[model samples]
Target: MYAAEEQAKGKPASVPRFSASRRNFLLKTGGISFASALVLAASGCTDNDAPNGGSLTPPNTTAIDLGSGDTGILNYAYALEQLEAAFYTQVIATPYSGISDAEKALLTDIRDHEVAHREFFKTALGSKAIVALKVNFSSINFSDRTSVLGTAKAFEDLGVSAYNGAGHLISSPDYLTLAGKIVSVEARHAAYIRDLITPGSFSSNVDSNGLDISAAPTDVLKTAQTFLTSKLDGSHLPS
Candidate 1:
């Protein structure tokens, strides 16, 4: 139905597909995992300040403010997930030239996971969710493997750090717990992408204390704005 709709609109259907076995695996296990997270986030994890839901409103300006408090933090995350999901979706739809079966399978899995994360945040944010972001991917050469994976590596690393940086701002333990779970998955993705780029370099980003480096929201948003066509205002984000 989705493909047909796209065709009817004269747009090439861009849906990503995987082998039957992989599809079934996602339908079973992936569904359960994200579903549980969604329930938790929507039920008991919402911040008290955003009882009616956080607003993505930007003050009389073109830039979209992420809002303050935990709401801002979650929206910040939602924006990053949106970017990752868009990148991987494009990667799968147009596989890089010479992409091997193993690489294809791994990338496809990453794409699905990103889509799950994107949707989970959108649903959990409810009406407070920001508008779907417009991404600028002109810098990426999807036809080349190195270009694709390098961008993927950057995105995964940035995502992990973004979560780690913002985790301390969350006052609600439930919300903090959810962020921890999501960041751990992001770390796994960063490790996998790193190893793919340079064999046995998964731990390259760790500090002397054996901890991954974290970036403040201002820093993360500064880098993220490069790939986003929509202007993001992190000035109001919790200090």
Candidate 2:
């Protein structure tokens, strides 16, 4: 982990789907402000003014400080949850111009689910969870449907692979169960979005030679590098 940690830094690129059913809500095109509000609300990071480094403060300094072990793995999931929740929340608040009503409604469901999962980890990990990540999506064009869905496909598929690959390193039975629950949902999201991006994309990808396609933490973080602004430390995390 230390050797791998030293040689770090990059960026992640991908797409995600959008949804929600609110008429009163509004967001500027390409603005993540509304999504940030939703994340704060969901993560229970209220605006009443927090201390500089309370228990919720992210221990992560550079990406390398993210650590390995249960803590690192939890933070890894935390990072992904932050990314997904933000993506879907943005999608629903200000959907693509030509998106259908049904698509909007379904996307809303996905957004809520990601929020629930994001909050669940925050609650479960308590003081050990990482802070809300600062993501850069300048590469993704939220205004375009195809770009959005393509990114969604990448995020969902990567998420599934990450959870699958890391299952063995988890120490707590309870946490394993929780991770399983979350991964299953991620898998469903992956499958649905893959089909959306291309009619038969999921058919070959999910069951590709029964290969599982899970990824190592090193690979997962490497793949996710495009969007991350901070460094991930995997030292305390499990190998």
Candidate 3:
């Protein structure tokens, strides 16, 4: 029925269906500003304010140091969480005109989770935490459903792979345990978004060995280059 409806409306068959119920849900939940108030309540960063107040528009820094050893790994994870949180913040702030309530809810949930993750790292790292990263979403078309969902899928998958790759690099058993827990959540996010884009595509990132792809810190930073405006100096991170 969804495919047929899209075809009738001249929309692509590939997109998710937005039924009447979804529209009604949007109207009902429209009063909630999950982007600001709700997210702050959900995140652990509520009490702690960074130099930039966790805003996206922070002063230009010469370079972001990821540090060395376990600290570097944590900073790397923190950086990725920051990027995810920032992206979802923008997604919720300026939702596509046609975005459905279901999309909004899912994206908002993701935003909250990312914010929580970001704060967790910041608190755990304490003085070792890197500055809040400045993101460049100029390449993203926020008003388009395809663009937003596609970008979300990319970030989710990248996050999962990043955790998987960085797991072995972490030396501390406690930090490794924490990373293990977070990676599972990231993988679930990846799967959920993939299904939203195309049903049953949850395993799209799986390789021939039936394992998710992993990347080095250098590789992960390179992939995230397009969305970041600040220069990241991950030179000291573990290989």
Candidate 4:
């Protein structure tokens, strides 16, 4: 939970920032390159891991409710992406000790991808988008490679499962399609991070049925709340 002073601040501790070159490119291309052609088509109007269960109601009255239906789902995703983007941004800002050049480059790419994903949801949702989330990463030690990679692995795996679980809840085909694309990218991230931890454990999390594990939104939110200062009310989310 955030302190009263922190809550009154009304801003995330770390907001993802893009380079000027990337910003200029996005402006020139109308963000099609990083966000995809679908973004231009609509202008565009649009649209975790935790335990394998948890309550949907927030822990406190000031919690941010995700609302109901598809819009609620989008907000849920945006919040997670915000958390990911913030985590990676901090990782890059303070490189873990003994970090190799190869590792740094790869992590930087992941950071950029997360930032792009975060921006995409924010743009698509427009007025419907929730406020930027306040993330709590004190548990992570940014100076240690083991700690950094471990957290990265957790976040990536959680993200993949989150999308898999939420897919059915999305009623819009366009939103579903977009979700599919993003999840695939997230899976790739998960695989890469897993391999980094263990040479060939990339697919270790897959089930006996050759499918990745999925968790309900309730479960995901329960775990996600651990790293978030803002309590989330998922009770109104689609069942």
Candidate 5:
């Protein structure tokens, strides 16, 4: 939860900064990619165990460690923000040939939201957070409309489930509230993307028991791993 005065610090970056161990963790998890290489080369010794102030360097891999406690929760949000921002940036950069004008507009809004979310965690975390994650979306065929939207829907749904699973682990009421608000929006994105894939797929995929479903971090990260160029260790994050 941003204080009234801090909300004005401008938008946050897509991911949190990292410590030495977390950086090593990301590199181990990240699948090798040209982007990953660039990120690695750029990184150098950053203060470890500081547990405050946002990181100054980009993470060596795509995964976010999140560590423990409220800061970890914020880092989780930051990681999702990076993923969404990366996906949408790619979506906008290489628009599908037959994409409708309306669809493009909606995607743009989604991109903006992701960017804002990314920046929010950065400011909140200040220096303790990991750096912006370097993303590798080469596996995705941006030219194919269905492929792009299908992946987008998966990511959005995963985000909602992830927040639901991890929210309970957060001790801070304010951060938990923020997670709740963000997860609801992610659910909306999931439903909207699902409907786009098929006229009525939204509610169908959503469990009859609830509007949103919870998922352990391992399950959530495993699914997300498909889109990432890095390998992630789910053992450290709250399940």
Candidate 6:
């Protein structure tokens, strides 16, 4: 019933619940400890497993592999952040027609926040960070107000769910803490965008249990494909 109403309002649909492979992986690794400060709790892992810092090279074939373990989770997050940062950058660069001054400022703030989040993950991941991603925004009619806000709403909602679903997959307590902080910001973005699309939609995102829905990394990437030119490989991520 809630989903039907939300869909009727043209809001993002809730992700259907799936098996808990990601949840199981989290439980198994939550107790394991890494030997190195930069490596995952799993054996034979190291920071060197990732690309060089500040490298903007996109992978060939347009398919990225989110490797197994905690690094994979971070890469998954970094990928999403890159998409968001690129999106808001374009949004601010070319404001949608009839956009208000207040809206412009708010969008700019969102852009800055996304860029900061993207850079934070990059810095945190260091050598483990994936290369810069290439995005496809051909579907978005950036000049239209409805189109822009709608896309923003979708991205923000997906981000919140992605983080919530991946929460348990994170084995490191410190990393989990950091993710919690970021997800809270993402949730705020979702709420703001939702309200912009429909006044009083802030609560529409909450389920009957008063909890936000979560999506496995794979499922999240499936939706993200709309804006991405590259193919995402979340198969390697813990599942």
lDDT of each: 0.76, 0.63, 0.70, 0.75, 0.62, 0.72
Models 1 onward score TM values of: 0.81, 0.71, 0.74, 0.80, 0.71, 0.75
The per-residue C-alpha lDDT of model 4 at residue 127 equals 74
The parts of candidate 6 lying over 4 Å away from their true place are 1-62
- lDDT of each residue in 1-239, candidate 2, tens digit only: 43244225221111122334243221121123333332322332222321121112235545545434555666778888888898888888778778888667667767776876676556545565677888778888888999889888888888889899889877655556667767776776776677766777664564546654688776777767777775665544556
lDDT of 4 by residue, 79-131 (tens): 88998999999999999999988777777777877887888777666677888
Q: Which regions of candidate 1 are displaced past 4 Å?
A: 1-31, 43-60
As a whole number from 0 to 100, the lDDT of residue 51 in candidate 5 is: 43
Query: lDDT by residue for model 5 over 1-239, one digit each (tens)?
Result: 43233235443322332211122211212122221222222122122323432322234464455654455555666777788888988899999879998788777666656665666556556676667776777778998998899889878878888898877766655556667766766766777788788988777655687556887665666666666664443334443
Instruction: Show model 4 residue runs off by greater than 4 Å.
Output: 1-55, 58-61
Give the lDDT of residue 36 in candidate 2: 32
Winner by TM-score? 1
- The TM-score that candidate 1 achieves is 0.81
RMSD of 2: 13.6
C-alpha lDDT of residue 56 in model 5: 22
Residue 124 C-alpha lDDT in model 2: 44
> Tens digit of lDDT per residue, candidate 3, span 16-94?
1122123332222222222223222222222122111111222245777666667667778989999999999999999
In model 4, pairs of residues that clash are none
lDDT of 3: 0.70
Clashing pairs for model 6 are: none
- Model 4, C-alpha of 206: deviation from truth (Å): 0.3
The 10 consecutive residues of candidate 6 with the worst lDDT sum are 26-35
The clash numbers for all candidates, in the given order, read 0, 33, 0, 0, 22, 0
Candidate number that wins on lDDT, 3 or 6: 6
